[model samples]
Target: MSRLLTAAAVAVTLLFSQNALAEKVSVEELQTGLDHPWAVAFLPDNQGMLITERSGSLRYWRQGKGLSQPIIGVPKVWAERQGGLLDVVLAPDFTQSRRVWLTWTEVDNNGRAGAVVGYGTLSDDNARLTRVKTVLRQQPALSSGANLGSRIAFDGDGFVWITFGDNFHAETAQDLSALTGKIVRLNADGSVPQDNPFVNKTGARPEIWALGVRNPQGIALNPWTQEIWESEHGPRGGDEVNIPRKGKNYGWPLATWGLDYSGEKVPGSKGGEVAGTEQPAFWWKVSPAISGMAFYNSARFPQWKNSLFIGALKEKNLIHLSVNGDRVTEKERLLSDRGERIRDVRMGPDGYLYVLTDERNGKLLKVGLAE
Candidate 1:
């Protein structure tokens, strides 16, 4: 018995030692002092980047130079808890059109606010946005404050996918008639695609591509598989990563692996196994508050090529997951407590992993393999 116990201790020690080694290659901070930065996108022609802050401002960054002054002409925003100016994406044909998309919280009738997606044209210098127009808006605005999980991704097909939260209305997730807690597909001009799953269905929101999500803050498209993936925050535990499919229900408030914040039983049970709802590709038992995700397609991180990198706001780290086709086989936690909240992760054009920190004074960090 003593021999067996000794062997077990040695095995545990080796496991911890391996994890520590993996954490060593992470990059230290390169720049700092950004103000509550949310989303980041690279310019197609140059090495500079455009970044958005939660306070309704946009800033520019060049390679050697630091952050530029807040770019003017951003639309006025309704900044509130979990709301305000959010994501930004460059058009695929940006060289010719100079178009960009933005998502934010907008105040509507009845003095309530909801999420909205819009488009704009970049100025001659690419430093300012002009001709802003609303492309999509959430319906039946909620009266109280809650989750607004807004993230956007542009598929190669020229269509855009937008993910919405339940707005604290858990029951709204299962309701296809509403736009809350759903993945919506839209054309470049913010119109619903004619081939959407529910375009012809009566009483359903024509923009809905999939339904039944909680607070899906992270959305990305896998360049290799052409698949759409999302990461969402669960009630207290059950943080989930899902590959959304059209017309399928995702089993939100009605079913979950997580419990309520008070530790009481959730409505539907441990997992979503109902007749029509789909299951998550991966789920974390202890909630990490996943905020951003990107698939590593760069050649610089050869070992991480085709793997998914996720930003964890609650844990303040980057969570790396290995993907075999559609399934997540393993996970590694990186940069734990080394920085503040990680808001976004992207594979840069320069063949390095770029990260945006979320805080009153955030940072733009670059990660690559160590020498």
Candidate 2:
């Protein structure tokens, strides 16, 4: 009877804990008129923020000034299906250089498409981007339009890290010569680092730091460890959280907890593990289609310190994971009541959490702990 009572108590505690976070959270609309906003990069010193729309527009927003007209001088993008202007992040020396980097799907004259990285100096008046230049482009543009995983980040050593999808071609993920389904490390100016993992390998792309990811849309440097973490979309299920390392292979079609969209097994998958592939730090049996992520290291939400916040596109919610070292101790899903596909989650410089909804008229929401 004592054992039964203890089990019952644990069940009740767990139930209340899950609901508590939801009830104690608040969402406020900062901008309600966005169109399919994909990412957010907060400006230094709270100057403002830059938001990217998948339909090839960049909007600037300030605290009391509201959203500005679309910034001019953005590159022409292939804004069809899953292709478009994607991520925008400030250069590490942004305060001094006023430079911002961006990623987008670039199309060739023959109609082939691939993701590219570029940067432009933000004009002093904030009216336009000037001096734009291309930095890197995925090699051998392809005909496919889906799964262009174009997220960008800067590591502590000032190296640029960009993620790419397999372009609906899973066979190329393990190919050393292919740039798809890979995490690439490059210098600020898009030059391949001499210390890159595959630099000396024969016939390999020297920019590749890690390989074998599928539709990875989330990338963030863990504040505590300074290590990069990624979230990826699997076929039917099997969404994963990974800490990508140099030369590591994150098994894709060859090992997954998911089946093909047609209810068949993935061609080479025996299970969720292959001898040469690294295991995911965590995985979901049912995919949530995660996107942008941010690590919360603020005091505004005392209960949320050391938590990792991720956007859930398929589930239309936000996920919070309490992380200690590299282990996840708790997981909670928030904003299910709103029924919006979350496209991005970011912690603001002012210690508040921001989220982007993916919709025809999407929204930029400011999230906080309920007072």
Give the candidate number with the greatest TM-score: 2
Residue lDDT tens for model 1, 1-371: 11011211111111112253353344645457676778989988666888888888887777556667777788888887778888998888888888888888887766677788898998867678888888888876662556788899999898899988998888888888887899999988788899999999999999999998988889999887898899999998988999999888888987788888889877655454665677899988898888889888877657776689889898888888888888895467776747578889888887777888888777777776664
lDDT of each: 0.80, 0.85
- TM-score for each of the candidates: 0.91, 0.93
TM-score for predicted model 2 compared with the true structure: 0.93
Pairs that collide, model 2: none
TM-score of 1: 0.91
